[model samples]
Target chain A: MPKRRKCLPCLSGLALLAGALLVAPVSAAPKRVMSLNLCTDQLAMTLAGPDQLVSVSFLAREPGLSMLHEEARSYPANHGLAEEVFLENPDLVVTGTYSLHNTTALLKRLGFHVEEFSFAQTLETIPGEVRRMGALIGQEKRAQAIADDFTRELETIAAGQCGKDPTMIAYDQNGIASGRGTLADSVMQAAGFANLAADMGVIGVAPFPLEQVIAAHPDVISIGAPQKAPTLGEFVTRHPAIGALPDTRIGAFVPEASLSCGIPSVIEAVRALAALRTEIAPCHGNAAQ
Target chain B: MKLCMSLILLVFVLFVVSLLVGPAELRVEDSIAGLFAGGSEAAAIIMREIRLPRALLGLAIGMSLGLSGAVLQGFLRNPLAEPGVIGVSSMAALGAVLVFYSGLAGSSLYALPAGALIGALLAILVLLAIAARQGSTLTLILAGVALSSLAGALTALVLNLSPNPFASYEIIFWLLGSLKDRSMEHVALALPLMAAGWFLIALSARAIDALSLGEEAASSLGISMSLTRFLIVAGVALCVGAATAVTGTIGFIGLVIPHLIRPLTNRMPSSLLLPAGLGGAALLLAADIAARIVLPAGELNVGVLTALIGAPFFLWLVVRARREML
Candidate 1:
């Protein structure tokens, strides 16, 4: 029986190698693509041709975490398990540097073509990342167009900002504020608001004391949209102290999941913040100059 | 009398200190003005909405734990009996986690106490049944250990099961407890229920004092056994349940406070209650303050601080207990 099992695999291996040799000449780009990270899933969905993206990580469908969650429903989801990716047997896999290090390593050892996007993304890197994903999926022309549009739109917004930069903080659940070296910080800076948490020497996401928030009195406190399920942490964002800050615009300024990643759609966050900055402190003098 | 006065003074001082200490570094005069005279809207909100609730919860939850611990010890004649030690707090935490995270009651804060009360009621009933059966002190403690472990496991399981990714992070908060961001809403929801529980527990003070002279001796003095049991069980369920509902299971405060304060009193169960409660408030407030100071930005859990102090004291008691048994 062991001899028969060995012979069976040998026969199938020969057949698979023959099949690959026959199919390799037909196409230069991978036909089947799987994304093992949420950020990668959105990128793949945007750039991959019809039927090219076989599956995306399950987080891609989470409305609170994914900007393209509506479109994600069309694709099947993977839980980023090496077993799932192996079972599907995609030609190329894309993931992020943030999580699933073990799965990525395992898939690489199995001889799968894996592409990784760094988790440390900023507005400046979005165009490059978009272009890279496009090239990987053989949609470089379309990717270049989108990247140029993003850069042009961002420059227009930056031109509209006055020298008077209002202070803002991306305060999320549990009093966590987005600080320096984060995507939110870049977006806030581009939208003409000084990142208060970052200026206070906070690095990345950390607990910004409600007391400090009241003391600093930033012109805007951008909170995350409330999740479907309740958490005690959510209550911190709705703290009365935040509500009581004089002349501060406290609300969900950025659309849900817009600022969570450095996608092309992050322009929505910048646009929204820039418009808000124009409304609160107009750039008439800057325009004249 | 002096002990009672000193404890009250201690609690008051700690409450003031808890209010004053924070990451904001507000001056004393500004904080006072903010709390009272409405000086800057920002300062007023910080004082009234932020620090006030945290300080208030510390005092109330601490008082509830200490008072319950003293009452349970006196009624059961078991020095080791406490809400956290006896599994009631853990069960209450489990109940809160189940109801709140499961989305059964939506996103309302009311779900916490409602579920916790049910969990605490079941725990107290079970413990009461065992006590009624004349279970040994060791049996009660062992049962408590089993219940606590089971509830802790279930609490973790429920948190992990929640669809919200952030819910898993809350397992530590529910298990270890924190008073970091409590507001007046929490205080309002819990204070009245806790006060009612205190009143019921206070009503049984005389009965517990009588029970300490042995059950038969207490019955001879006209203390109804059934009435006393009902009061303690209901009171404990309300106090511990509501407290755990808001802050999770703050271990060792209920266990340690009564023991420490007992020495300051005349050794009578009824007399030990008030001072123990005051001492509990002082201890909890001090621990909460230390939690902020220890790691200013990402504060330590208040339960961690209490466990640090109480775990050692609990071991000392166990050793003494073993020596006495020998």
Candidate 2:
């Protein structure tokens, strides 16, 4: 009877362990996800299967400014405020470096699993962010596939049009231009136009003189269309010299979503640049003489 | 009349040149042809759609600022008085910024101007309340300075707090002021308010001329001090608030243009208003053209350029004013 009683307790313990094992995987997979930035909000929607996401940053739904306005409409959105995020009881929270510091700290204090992504201004850092995001969501294979696709797109665009002449410059409206080490510079390079800015030996954000733009006589001028400023076209056209550039094909290029804010957008940006190469090539060839 | 006709002709000539010259370099004949047969599709788009509206808006905004500045300075009886100095511009800017950042105006085009006008009106009322008690030029100037500084500080703080990186850049351009990319919408919104303001200011011009002899002398001359003050303040507020609502804060145009043209009209505030309006129009148009041409594919703010040119002239005027006082 004593031996039987001991055996019964052991069996109950085993059963409890088995029950926990069965429930663990189901609960571990994030059913309720919260995104704390516009970039992450966009990524979550793209990566997470439908009906899995709980909330996105309020910025995602701003049609005038958000690149993913249409997609963002489906999710209940938060302002990325700590109180708001915590109230939702999300299984996973995705935030960026720019997310409110106090909110992030408080979430960690409460033993919540919070993942943070870095803001990438350059192309090289994109893959790491992708892998990190993949590991967090248990979508490592999908993430790897997306990363591989990004690399392939960039490589293809680079191989096809990287050698084309009549160097171009990515002029950000408001007198800002991308120098070396910027994703814009990478895009310009992939589009078959040398970055005249790179020739100045300056990296990151540098002042490109309007006189230099004239002197460089770039074969093409590519303007970056920031989502916030829709009136950028008006501002750019107001400059008499931009209007006067001879044989220059001036077009605003929307960087792919992955390249713009995350790993996925980088590939999209490359594809967009590749498409622009055809338009730029003729202008470059004509300007060469 | 002859001078007015010549100024009108000069404005017409400037307007024509502005329409003709742009980044695209359309010839005069081509532009005219474009205006009529709509020339080539691109040229028509450029002339009718782009340059015409920009130049007209520039003309209207310049006229409003210039005329309003003249009235404010004349009423205050102080040459240092300008729209920005009196808090109208800063308030309008703050209003515009609030509308832009709050997401209230995010979906609507009209919200920005409407908010800006409301801000301007609020600022004007505040200034009037402060100035009414003392009814002295010194008190009015002090009140204006305090309000202007507060408004500027608030703008800076709001820009700093905004998560959008572009907000600071927008503030810089707003402070510097420009008529570039202005559309007919701005003109349509601003013109009636400015015209009404101008009529009110013109009526107060004789009163301003009377006040130059001293406020008591002006009152003795049958100009009720309270009525004159009310009309002038209201007029200046309406004109400047409307102008800044659309164009942002264009500095020094009011102070410099009025002073520059004051001598031509024998320093009579009543006579100076019209020519000052014309001269203001010419000066701003010229500045706008310079802003466009100074850099290839780059433009300077007309306000900055004007301030760079005006500040020195202002210093000289101050030194002269001080020397005369001494």
Candidate 3:
């Protein structure tokens, strides 16, 4: 009984020491950060300084989706799974709203700070999200600068195409569409084309009927492609109806990075759309002529 | 038996309730008046255009699956055998995907159902050929596993290859199954095929019962196993394939309903068929209602909810059955 009593204080002291060690690391900010979501990875790479970003989601390297694929290639890539995130001992982790909830919960429980970006449907909110992300990662100045550059680019693109009544459709994989209140909608509007999908009142990621597309008869069709394999040009050829649409111009808006992520990508997409309109000028001239 | 009847009644009540409720709620009197007198425009549109068709389609799909599942279980003498377990549902999904993504359905309204039925028929043919040669349920199951996996992989490959983002999303959601946004046109297309398939299966219930007494005994009783098998495959393919073509792959209803109702019918395959059909319709309707009401903001797929509930129940059943056998 006397020996047992003595062991109690020893065990208590050991537990206290272990608790202090666990608490010590959490108080200091994470030095090496990894982003597991495509959207967050874009922001992290953009604002967190190159050396601080240890890894990014593999999707960040896709040239079709990300505007920064070339820059993203320098960093290691993770597949957005929790196991992959843990291997790098990331001080800060970023994920998306649609990301696996259980995995995010598990990481938070393990004393890791995870910043989750919910699906931002509108363009107005994207700039705020960028600022929030900047504050989280200690890169508020870089974030604000990028945000300003994005708004300026958007205004320039919008100014150039102000008078044109260009009806546009964003043909994505599986006949799915970005309706009103989507980033794609802002991109379309910024590029000086009225989105046919917005007119149809599509709000989220839902399958739009092919019949609706056929009926809309948009002036230009922009097909979103994956970063790798079967480019938008190939996609257009595969669907004969899209290719054969009367007086319609087809274009590919490949941002190759942050283009689809938020505000910066939206600006990039607008520029791409403007370039597409210029390239298709002859087609429009021939139709009018 | 009494409990089964009450449950069936409850499902019927639920089906009626589903018919009456929607995104736009109407009073019971207005809905009833619309049903009979063709009165209020909103009421008529809701009753005739939306709810009636959805409810009926739900009923037909439920019955077809229930009947087909019961028949397959009885024939195989294994409760574990489901339509999906034997490659029918995946093949049906593949067929629907082919028609949907290939723009064949874009050309003609009939193309979707016809293409799906063809795909299902081809799969059934393959299953029949394998089952015949092996003459063992274990071998048949292995063949089914291979066929289902191949079909699923092929469907995924097709979706991936397709440039249409909506087509890919549709492939995922369709395989999961739902009845939302389904119109009267879908009902019109699926009903005739479902009716024909149901008739074929209903005709074979007695034959299925005869086969339970051993192949030789059934043969002596003037039932040809080959003919019976052909009829069942064709019937199941037509009904299930058509239903799936319209609604995507809805799992568990056919598998679960028969098992639930079998005991009430004294384990007689023939006796169990009709009740099983009723039970299936009720279960699907209830599930659909729950799906709508549970998350009013977001429409949940009926197949997903059923699978979520059914998978755990099925696991429990397997454990219980194993314990009894031991």
What's the CA RMSD for each of the models? Answer: 5.9, 11.3, 11.1
lDDT of 2 by residue, B1-326 (tens): 77778888988888877787676666778789876785655566566656776788677777767887787777767777777767788888777667755556553446566767777777777877877456565576677778777877787777666665556666765577776656555667778877887888888888989987887899889998878877776677677777776677777778788888786777778888898788778877888888888976547878888788777876787788778778
Indicate the docking level reached by candidate 2.
incorrect
Candidate 2 lDDT over A151-243, as tens digits, reads 777776665653345577777655566788877777666656678888767587665544346545677677654445332223543355566
Worst 10 residues of 2 chain A by lDDT: A229-238
**Rank list by DockQ:** 1, 2, 3
| DockQ metric for all predictions | 0.57, 0.05, 0.04
- Write the candidate numbers in order of decreasing TM-score: 1, 2, 3
lDDT of 1 by residue, A1-289 (tens): 7999879989999999877744552346788999989999888887888999999988999999999999999999889999998899988889998889999999999998888999999999999999988877778788999999999999988877666789998998888998999999999999999999999999988889888998898999999887888888898898776876778999999888997788899999899998899898875753637
Q: Which candidate model has the greater TM-score, 1 or 3?
A: 1
Candidate 1 CAPRI classification by DockQ: medium
Kindly state the fnat score of candidate 3: 0.02
Q: Per-residue lDDT for B218-259 in model 1, tens only? A: 999999999999999999899999999999889998889888
Ranking by lDDT: 1, 3, 2
TM-score of each: 0.94, 0.64, 0.58
Q: Please report, as a residue range, the 10-residue window in candidate 2 chain B with the lowest summed lDDT.
A: B100-109
